[model samples]
Target: MGKERDGAGQVRPTTSLSPSAEFPPLSAQDIETLRRLGEQWRVEKPARALPVDPELRPSRPGAARARGPDEAFRPDQPGELTATPAAERPDTSRGRFALRVRRVLLGPPLSSMSMLRERMRKLIALPVLSSDLLSSVAYGPEALLTILVLAGSAALGLSLPIAAALVVLMLAVGASYRQTVRAYPHGAGSYLVASDSIGPRAGLTAAVGLILDYVLTVSVSVAAGIAAITSALPALNPLSVPLSLAVIAALLAGNLRGIRVAGNIFAAPTYLFLVAIGGMTLFGLGQAVARGFTVIPPPPVPATEAISVLLIARAFASGATSMTGIEAVSNAIPALRPVEWRNARTLLTWMISILILLFVGLMLLTHLNGLVPRANETLLSQLAHRTFPHGPWYPIIQAATALVLLLAANTAYNDLPRLLYYMARDAYVPRRFLHMGDRLALTNGLVALSVAAAVILTAFRGRTQALIPLFAVGVFLAFTLSQVGMVNHWRRHRGSGWRRRAAINALGATLSAIVLVTAAITKFASGAWVVVVAVPTLVLLCLGIRRHYDRVRQAVSLHPTPTQLTSAERSEREMAQEFLPQRVHHLLVVPVARFDQAALRALAYVVSLGQPALAVHVSPEDQEADRLRDEWTAWGDHVRLETVVSPHREILEPLAQYIAQLRERQPDITLTVVIPEVVVNRPWQRFLHSQIERRLRRALRRLPGVVVTSMPIHLSEVHPQATR
Candidate 1:
């Protein structure tokens, strides 16, 4: 046995050992560690020894005990005890009660610093930035092919060179936006830029176009994604529309739940798709370098050669479509971290890099594969078959390209709601869109996107190319307005060396504007006109809404009045007061067979106040009135009671007759007519209740020698907490 010191400091439990018989004392460091462990253990232990007041416990599973500086009080149930006079009522405590619980779950109220971090996190999650940006990869390629297809198979060779130009321009544009992100990291994308720069109408126009495009983005992206899935699984081919809608619903649910969760879910697939395409591009490039210049050959086409400059400009316009959702990032600056500018810039850089790689990769692959576009067909699908050898990889490449095509609208899905939120905050749209639900998700905006997308999908019948002409026109219109705004913004701040930058930006704006004109002219009949019309209509709608809000504000003006009440009018009020009894001993009120709680409470209160109560009943049918009189006959000896009957079954006539009789009998005595009413708690509840008090009050007002007192008593027990 080992020897140990007992609590009394005496040696105990001795065991023979060859080693040292006495143990050394713990070192200072070891003592500290043991002390820390003991403290931690104490802190983690249950609060069994702590004093617990029996009254502090919850009365039931769902019940909460009140807490206050004073002892908590529970009011007696209605009818269980008589109410004391108002003068004698107990004073209720004016502080919140303590709650008895093992733990409380809540973060400290957000400080500005915390808020700034949350904002940045939310900005990154904004679907518009990621989904919208990635989706561009899908259709940006398609847009390029659609244009090249018009110029002929040989002209399609120029696709890469043109794409190369666009790619350089995209990088320049991306760089320009980097400045925008830093400058206006507060959010409200192109609309803010346009409105402040160009004017309200232009800004509103941009907002409408962006909003419409956002809706289209969701529909197109989901449809494209579905189309890609269908290409891989022929069994799911016919279910594209329905499956697309289901995917939209799932996305809506995910987004509505929380932006963070949605971000986590969509980010991996989106990045994967990006990497997969990037790898395909690298593989195709490697093939070209190894195999030398051998064209993959093309599918059947109308012509073997290229097209005109007008057609080429139109194709460029189509290719420029990829830039549509770029503004969505600037619009969502408020959602970014405290360092919103940095985060947005980083996100933009990521976006721009991916966009360049995608644009170049697809164009190069298309040229190598010898793909040509028909007036209506997709070139990626056509090119995929030619570029990749006729093997298992052939189906894989086709499937991936198609998937990218379908998800291209992902950018819009993210962007539009953010646009809606800003517009709503400005009162250009419904205020509901700005509401963030319990999970801090833009639930309303998500729902709106889902519905609008479904409608567009149904309207277009999921034809991807059919929506393309209308698509880029809005994007370019927004871009032009944005560029113009930037130019003006810089000009205003000319003192800051922005004048030189302004001129260059103005040139960019002019070029963008010219491109916009070209896009509109070329695609007007093709479908861009629909967007042009739709955008203006949205502007008008927002303006109309603003006008309505203005009218309401104007109507509710609270300006102070200078005029005071005349002495004669004040004397009239004095005269009315003179007629009231100094001490009202008795009051009369009509009673029905089925008296509501308000009426009973009013009567009980009067009786409890040591005043005699009078009851008057009017019945169109004498028998019905007599029956009610009989019910209250037992209490008639304690108070004055009267019943008036009408042979013609008219309530008004009987009430008039009774009032006249009361005036003749007690001209000097106070005749206070008590009117009881049910108070509804909710707006919808008001519609379900009767408006009998209104009509009765009107009738009482006509009496010359009468005092009407509205006695509103508790009906359904409305707790003070309930009102709060």
Candidate 2:
């Protein structure tokens, strides 16, 4: 028999195969039979598994209990069969059993690398990818209004110019990404494109920016959604933080069900929101034009210092929020249907057209009417109320706006995990981030994003305005790097019409750089400084990770030893001199906390093994150690007893250091430690215990040539039958 680890890292046993009896794999059809057998017999626990319950043991069924020489029993569950050791069997304590039931409820474990493909059709792909892009309209135009109103009513007249400039920037970023979609075909987002063209440092810069962007997107979207709700229902405003957290929890659950299911649930809201906004814009404009385009009187401008070029650029920078989610489709090309890139690009085109239609229409209507941003109500909420004045359409538009804002994080939900997966594959993050949970979703990344967003939401007190300044800085930074990288890519490759493509990317790079600087300089005082400090710090960490991986590669490389290995290959070990000691000393030591059935069985098991065994007790002080010794003398076994003094009350490390000294003194002796654990019957009770056995094993496994084992004495375990 030998040891092997399953995909989940659980150790199990394997049997040697002969030529005549090759392993014929079991199929899904045989699963029920295996489960039935599992009910009849307990599985053979592998290394490090807790032992069976020792108290109130059940007598085996008569038929299966009596085995003949030729009768062979095969269990389809993992591990090979062997005679039961002196160690106890599985702890069927209600708590352990309850844990098994809870695991089953969560779902079956996916096979290693068994990634589920959710190739979405174009229809569903639109909402799954564009939720962030389309939902931004709820706040994008308002963001523009927010900046323009700062200079009072005269600056408000410049809304048309600001809106027009933002429109041009939006088109340039959209077209740049469309080219990126074709050039890469696979993910053409900043992380990949910058890595390819501008080197990995540039790529990591983009990666950090995108990570910040995704997390901030979730935070901002949720806050905006809460603003929508509170605007309509002022009474609920007091519960803003709790409401934001609840909505985030719901989104986390939806995404955990998988992207396809999430897309199906969230897609309808995008269409509905589009219709609401589209109808309001058309009717509002039509009514205005029909009444001879009569201008609504503007609010009075307040006296102030002159508006400088910096002030105007700051307004453009603020208006740039409208373009925040435009890069989502490009970043998520793989999430689309077959011919993924082509379908993704087509979907991108539709999203952009609709966005332009609704965004420009709202901008136009804002100019036609004397609308300004209000603290108590959203810009869209005001427009909706004004457009439909006391009708059903007003509430319908507001509801759709709220729903779309809530679902906007779905874009980050879809893309961030995929981004983290890419980062993990490149060794920049922990490997766990690459794993799919039982539900086949990137559960680690999903949960991590949710927690991060929730913290930010609470920290900012659920205010969208407080968080909005931190949004576009990360986005425009990525945009700048992606576009600049593409220019280098096109210039070097010189594909057909490469010069024209290069120029387009160059223009994008230039505009994005300007926006990036403006955003940093204008919003820096208003909290963009946090992002300014964060991106480089994250990039430096990435650099450190790359250095570590490089060092590990060099350490593990076999390139330096090909010739030395040839001489060592001829060296043979004499078993008598190498492994067989003159008189082998097998020392079994049981670590005891008190004298009970647990300690007795541990001692009795080593005695049953017919080895030289002793019981060692660790206590916080000499007084307690002496007391344990005196108690042992009264309730005595014939075995010798030892006491280990732990002055600091540290059980594992002191015992480990003592054992190391013992090993150094007697190099010939082999060490075996047996730990006795009480298995609890309730799910909650398991947490109440310290689980010292686990900590002991962790420490002992680090030592050379030591065997650590556990005997789990179940406090209470229901037998006869349990849910398999």
Candidate 3:
């Protein structure tokens, strides 16, 4: 055997002249037969051709059963060969599986400062965060208004005073949350606070409440804001609910784009809305004080019918909604710059300052501008017209305030997903919720929240008051539990120097819990049942999450010992034995018409491997057979040629039978079937020739004791080397 090159400078097949017969160069008809054989037996193993007859070889008694050689075997039938290995036994070790998981999720060091910065920016801008925060501002007033409604407008004179008190309470809560930001700065807010202070169950409960509140905040606020806009611009009146839903959709899409895009998009509106509300509050206050106004009133506000003292307490409890997003700064403390605690406190101050101004300013403007509260109209819109001196600023202020309220709901877009991401990491929610899209945003959570909020908005027709009482109750429940959890947390950790601080938290928890009960009872009839329902739902969900974690933990646990790698190695070794070594004598059956560059290449590869090769072709008639024989004699040079005549004009059957006869004469000879195959580079080109390849492979697979190899030529796969 000598080194040979195909047309492509790769391996090509050659033939050895039979000792007693001559060889032939393949013609067009001979090549066609070769191509058909190659197609049919492409997947079949070629038989190793040998010079010595198998019947002459001495057979051992036990080797018959051990080697499993059957006398009935045919080279064309692949299934007759018992050379393949058994299946690999699976390893069931937990440590090995865990190593695999780690290799996949946490690969080679790919992190850099730029990547970390990018991830941080993206997480901060997540749509869930924006939607979560903004949603709070929308319903923030409803709780206050409902409280005044139950307590009566006579107590409404005290609404500002009560709001002032609520502001103080909100400040305390905010301060306490600052500690949370410093301690568990994961943007998970209340869940972290409760989980660290109490346990995972407590944490999950807080998470569920926070999530529900975040969702409702988006729905309720958008609905109410739309209503406010409608009150100012009546022409947009028809689309109030749908338009609110539209805003939700747009925000959701923005979030899906990625966190950074959403953050940058929402950040401006969020701050602008904040400034607008702050500006309105100060402008209204300066105007009221400058005008020497003594609380102008258009009419007497309505009084609820002989409300119980408990009702009065319940009504007061509703105002706590003003504190809905009080913990947001703490929740998102991680999004701040370094020196997170100091930055958080400053941010807290800024947020609280703006919140206080908006709450007091809106209420005071309504009172000072003779803007009476109505069942449907916004006090802010009425105040905008009355307090702004009735000029161009009137429409602008009205629009600005409405826009501010709408944009406030965008905060929910940021908060909800961040919190859910944490919950998902803890295995409390579906892992999908933790997925970040290509844009590095929690797109799944954003879409889920958006759809959920839209459903609520549609279901309730965007009524702010309808969703109001339900809002703060769940939040305050978390607040109360968190406060109590903190008190316990502090007590357990405190030394001699912290006794006073512990007492203060104890008092705070005691007071908040009492207020929680009062609010729950007083607001129950006024749609507070929604919060009541939320608590149990959240509890059940947490329990379910715990169950899932436990189940997964149990499923993949490791055993004491593992089996060795003996079986697997043996199986692969047996599979490799089916292939024949080079230097084997064999008859090369080449269908001449099929003998394209691919066939020639395959023949070159087989012959270079030192196998004795022959060319086989079919003849249709006596004259054609004689002509083929003459052509074979002329092309023989050194190789032998064999010809088969088909009487019924069937190709595969006759060719298959000819290979069978050769296998019987020399069982050790490997019959190398040279098939020319077209290699297509493009996807569409594959559709053209795939069917013929499939049919050929299927028929050849049934042949026994044969190994088949396919040699593909680049017809269209490569353009004939680009001529310079």
Best model per lDDT: 2
Model 1: runs farther than 4 Å from truth? Answer: 1-128, 304-306, 374-378, 382-410, 495-500, 557-724
- The best-first sequence of candidates by lDDT reads 2, 1, 3
- Model 3 regions more than 4 Å off: 1-115, 119-143, 146-153, 291-293, 495-497, 559-724
lDDT of 1 at 309: 81
lDDT of 1 by residue, 1-724 (tens): 1122211223434221111211224545446645544443322234466465433457477876554444344346533432223322344332111111101221112222232334436433543366566566667677777766765566666677778767756765666566566555556667767776677688788888788777877776776666556555668766767877777776776565444445555555555566666777787788888889576776655663358788777777788876667776776665555566687888888888877877777777777767665433355555555556577665666555555444445555556767776666456778677665544555577788889889888787776677778777777777778777777777766657686666656665665676688788988998888887888788899989767755553333221112212434453234333323442335455444244466566677667655546766676777886676665664353445567777776665567568767777877555667776677655587678666666667777787667776767444574556334
Superposition error at 636 for model 3 (Å): 34
Worst 10 residues of 2 by lDDT: 14-23
TM-score each candidate: 0.65, 0.76, 0.60
Q: What would the per-residue lDDT of candidate 2 be over residues 1-724, giving only the tens digit for each residue? A: 1122222222334221111111223434345544543444432333464476323233564534334443243333445443331122235566567756645554334432333355578999888788888888889888877877777877777878878887777777788888888877666388777877887788888988998999999999999998999999999998989999998998998888666677888899988988888888899999899989886866675735456688778778877887787888877776676687788789888888888888889988877778888999998888887788886887788889999898898889888887776665565666566677655678888998999999999999999999989998999999999999889988888989998888888988888999899989889999999999999999998778756755564343322133434644532122122233433577887888987777877888988877788787879999898888887888765788878887879888888887777677888777898888888867799799898888988898887657788887887643424322
C-alpha root-mean-square deviation, candidate 2: 10.5
RMSD of 1: 19.6
Give the clash total for candidate 3: 70
Q: In candidate 2, how many Å is residue 249 off?
A: 1.1
lDDT score, residue 66, model 2? Answer: 36
Sort all candidates by TM-score, best to worst: 2, 1, 3
Question: What TM-score, to 2 decimals, does candidate 3 have?
Answer: 0.60
lDDT of 3 by residue, 523-585 (tens): 688777877887788678766865676466433222111222253444422322333243345
- Which of the predicted structures, 1 or 2, would earn the higher lDDT when compared with the native? 2
Task: Give candidate 2's whole-model lDDT.
Answer: 0.77
